[model samples]
Target: MASRTTSWAYRPSLDGLRMLAMYLIILFHTQVPWIQGSFIAVNLFFVLSGYLVTNVVLTEMERTGRLDLGRFYARRVRRLLPAALVAIVGISLVFLLVAPVVRRLGLVGDAQGSLLYVANWRFIAQANDYFAPNVDKSPFLHFWTLSIEEQFYVVFPLLILLLARSSRRGVMVAGLAVVTVASIGAQVYWATADPIHAYYGTDARLYQLSAGALMAVALRTWPVRLPRVGARAVAVGGMALFAVLCFSAVAMSQSNRGFLGTAACLMIVAGLMLDEDQPLAKALSLRPVVYLGQISYSTYLWHWPAILVMGMFLDVGPVTMAALAAVIATGLAAASAELLEQPVRSAKRLNRFRWRVSAVGVACSVLAAVLVVPTVLEREQPPAVASGTGGAAVGKLAAAHSDPLPKDVDWDRVDRDRGTEQTCQVDDLDRCVLHEGSGAHVLLVGDSHARMMTAMFEQLAKKHDFTLSTNIVSGCPWQENLRNTQSSPKRQERCDEARTGWYDTVLPRLDPDLVVVATLPRDHGKWHQRLENRDGSDLGLERSLLRATRDTLDKIEKVADRTLMVQSVATPRSFVPNDCLTSAKDPDDCVVPLTTTNRPSDAYYLAVAADVDAAYTVDLNPAFCPAGPLCSPVVDGMVVWRDNQHLTASFVAHQRAKVWRLIQQTGVLDALDGL
Candidate 1:
């Protein structure tokens, strides 16, 4: 049998396809209303990469009867590493110089992962949901896709080389089919079970790449014999369908993986199958479109960081921000391509020094790691303060409204203790006793807001002779059948499961004497103001919230003798307390107005309490806000909030007396006294 050899040609239609995909991604990041499904562009890129790279490997193997692994790796390193290293080093330096310590803390790890081409796995391991609200976007986030491509570049060639001596085409086709099936299966399973992780996982995304590879193999080994008219029709129809899908109301969510992946693969196949002289192909081959496609990689690399940097200082509307981001990204991409990418790619002498390039990349990664040392050390050390003051110093500082806030008070420590560390609260059915005592058993159930009360509750538990058990999940309310509209689908799934498990399993087993429920009402306000829904429907927010809260309280009443519902605290509008304090010359500058409607109203809780006989509403606003026109970030010389709404552990400790009094006034403690 004779092996077949074919020459590769430049396809302008493919370049046009690349341009379209890149622009869609940019628009998605801009967060325009109609382009919600723009994330599918990534799948399109994967398919294109699979087809082009597979075709290259197959052609080379057929012509030479073997693969040159060294040359292949060297080519990949030269093409990708230089621009990537520049971006990583430049972004890291900017962050260290300008960003707040809190924000800079995680960049080192992100940089290291990106440098090693494993950033996707790093993000997945951190449970960093791409759709999370109000969270700062990582500059290295776009590197995840590049990481996947690089992994494919390394592995796919080796596979082809291994099969070169045997019935290569037959075995390769069979292997690709198995891979495609397994990858798709994994995607479907993970999309249902853990969507956020599934979105970033290599296993879930391999099918799209495999689809392209299969198309390449089929074209080479058993070419499609469609009539010219049939081929043109397929190309036109596929392009039309792809455009419709990209612009349609379909959500780019985890559950829609099959549709998204399949659509992207089909688009790539159509682009490949079409003849160059076809009308659609001629349009795609235009000079401007090809130019845009040429710089697509650089555009993708620079756009995210440009947007993030602009967001850090600019207080502009979304449209304005998006426009500014686009301009900056374009300029950077053009400059990078002309000055850096082109010059490096054309330097033939450097191609022989592959080891040197690898070494340089490694050295840059080491520098990034070194840069994060101070932040790591700072996190490990506890805040310096007077011994046995028992939070009195913070109280005094707040009362004085000290200009230079106490340097000894560790704001980060306050944040860490407030359930950000998973150990502080029970997320699943597993019991987490926050504080053990000989007194009555009191269970706290809510989200991070409830976790914020841990220090105060623990103090109260010790003073009032009560034990504390916490069942809390961050960003999750205690309400049943209600989803966090701002969270990713996977997070919502976990929240629902955890809530169901607590209500069904944990509560019944423990049967505590008192149950306390509290969550940040900011989420509830988002539900109402944005009129958001779990499924993105336009439902009646107020009614839905009331029903969910009522159902949750009803469940709690069944398992506990008494229930206490805490009123949501006053959260400043668009203000981060720590950021305010960091730059304040006078502590008074840190104070924000606390208008009656500044925070989310307790209408849902009030409505739920009116119906549930066992549930009693506890208003702590008087103690925290005290009928004030303005609220201070520092209360009694201690930081009142770690961020906007969450209370600092030190401040909460200072208010232990007020919290204990409120718990006693509920008459549940008096009743527990008899027990």
Candidate 2:
């Protein structure tokens, strides 16, 4: 194959690799049931980026005997910035308009994170679960990959220059190998220690980039002369392995990212070295495939938001959403490339001074962060509160007067739920303390269900003048070796690990005035289809809950004078915030009917509370569901449930006085005092 007129030859087959990587990523985002491991396409993109960037740097250095950072930075700016700026600004504006207020709040910070190329760390701090279906997912989540790539781009040039200047080819090779090996080690270690961090962390992903750079260095500094037969075998085998790694997977997991990265490295090395006339290389260089590859950056930028828009607002199925996302993303990317990207990159003035052009990218990013993101959150007057005189019943207040249905503004603040996340979302409960008080020391343990009652407990502790320390983990119970059906299998290994500090050591050490246990007694409110027994028993949900419950009872029986089993409040089947915000004029729209025809009884919890000695139960069912026929989510101008099952801190604060009276009536605290 003849080289192009530019310093480097135009490798259309490399573009084919880009097209395939993006295709897999888009498929993954659409939640294709069979494409669970397609996220590994990001590794391919990382590796490809490393190879191309290193090629550009080395080619310039070899020709001029010195690489110009200014020109390289400028070229990158003109090549990348225009399309990125347009996508971030345009996509954010659309999301602000269509998404609910609660969903839009994070865009302010995320927009800035995207522009500044630190979205990976931002996402890490937020503890985002990339695969979980239940949590609120940001459309900007995909930007984490871009952040990692950009970080490598900024640092790798200087590092590679130093390695090249070392004057020894062996040192350069060793330096690159060290980076690749160390980063892979980080990926393996973090994949086990904390999967979320492992996925998003820059340290864990450097190997993919370094592997590509190494391949580039090998080919650039020291050319490889391979026989045609040998090169053809590598091309065939590498592409085959790449396909298998992406297609042959069970769950959306990070465990196999290293293997995927290795495969990506193989794919690039094989493609780059193989003759263009080879069948695999010829197919990759097809006009349509190469065009798709050219527009892939913009396509990737638009596809995530497109899928999110389709899924959230359109009520479409995942497959249909995926198709629409692909179509819309492709169309937008084509337009962006034609109207926005090509003009800016090919402009004579931008070609002359890349730094000034690059500044425009920074300016556009700042504009998106400050202007576009804020527009998504409409300024709202705070919700009016009416704490009626002298502990008036919320039921009577709502019945006699109009109760304020939750506004979009209200749910936005409450839904963030930092207390719940900080306290219960950890794999370790030792450090997740909610409060430290001066009076009696009360120990709280369970999961998110327990954290929901935090506001009431906060009120209880403040009024009672006691210190409250909690050991809580979301989705997992206090009992060891149990995991819910919801978590990925790899993550399930750490399910009981959350209780490690508290279960065996903290409870025994604290031995507080009282030990309080609160959790969802039934899994998804169904005993038959709940948690699996990790000990490999087919004990299923009921027995799992039984063992978990018994474990809790035994721990509490030994640790405290008395125990209080806090029952979860009556759960509303109707989606909170969504239903309430939709029918804002009618307070009853979000009501949970407690009629025998609609309500489900807490039979298991009641039974468990009745049988255990030295244990008293506090069920806030009456407080929340005061009127037996219908339980209102909004009572006396306060939103009750933040989501379907969890109570808002504001509502809990409003109900705390009543909850205190209920606890006084239970005589559990008083009984402990007598002990």
**What shift in Å separates residue 412 of candidate 1 from its native position after superposition?**
37
Candidate 1 C-alpha lDDT tens digits along 245-363: 66638655654744554664565455445455567777777999888888888888888888776654454665676677767777777898898888888888877777676566557
The lowest-lDDT stretch of 10 consecutive residues in candidate 1 is 383-392
**Per-candidate count of clashing residue pairs (backbone under 3 Å):** 8, 0
TM-score of each predicted structure versus truth:
0.58, 0.58
* Backbone clashes in model 1, listed as residue pairs: 394-636, 394-637, 394-638, 395-636, 397-637, 398-636, 398-637, 399-636
Model 2 clash number: 0
Question: Which tens-of-lDDT digit does each residue in 183-293 have in candidate 2?
Answer: 988988999897878989999988888888887777665655566666666677776666666663644356575566576555645555555667777888899999999
